[model samples]
Target: MKWTDINDIAIELADSQPDTDPLKVNFVDLRDWVMALPGFDDDPKHCGEKILEAIQQAWIDEVA
Candidate 1:
């Protein structure tokens, strides 16, 4: 998944970190976790604040 794949990445994150709270995650750590995802295949430099925020929001929704 790339930077724009927000929903997919969020789902992966929700499943990977079920005990973690997405809203408490900082952008730096969030980016790292996203990169560490099994199917993630995007360039680190391609991700930005907006993308990370969207991913976090989606993860919040996923876990809700």
Candidate 2:
């Protein structure tokens, strides 16, 4: 599914779903997911940040 909002990702992760598969990306709970990966292997913190940043960037680009 195509997600255009960071909130959705955070919401999914809250359910303990999978986030490894970019296609099945669910959540990015920083507190519970960070330090769970090699370089953020399954690190929710890093993942959350990445997704949030992407969303923010997209929004910026849309207006720019």
lDDT of 1 by residue, 1-64 (tens): 8989999999999999989999899999999999999989988889888888899999999999
User: Which residue pairs in candidate 2 have backbone atoms (N, alpha carbon, C) closer than 3 angstroms, thus clashing?
Assistant: 13-27, 33-44, 37-41, 37-42, 38-41
Over 4 Å off, model 1: none
For candidate 1, the C-alpha RMSD (Å) to the true structure equals 0.6
TM-score between model 1 and native: 0.95
- How well is each residue in 1-64 modelled by candidate 2, as lDDT tens digits? 1233344433444333342333333334343442332233333323345565564443334333
* Most lDDT-accurate candidate: 1
Estimated TM-score per prediction? 0.95, 0.29
Please identify model 2 stretches exceeding 4 Å from their true place.
1-47
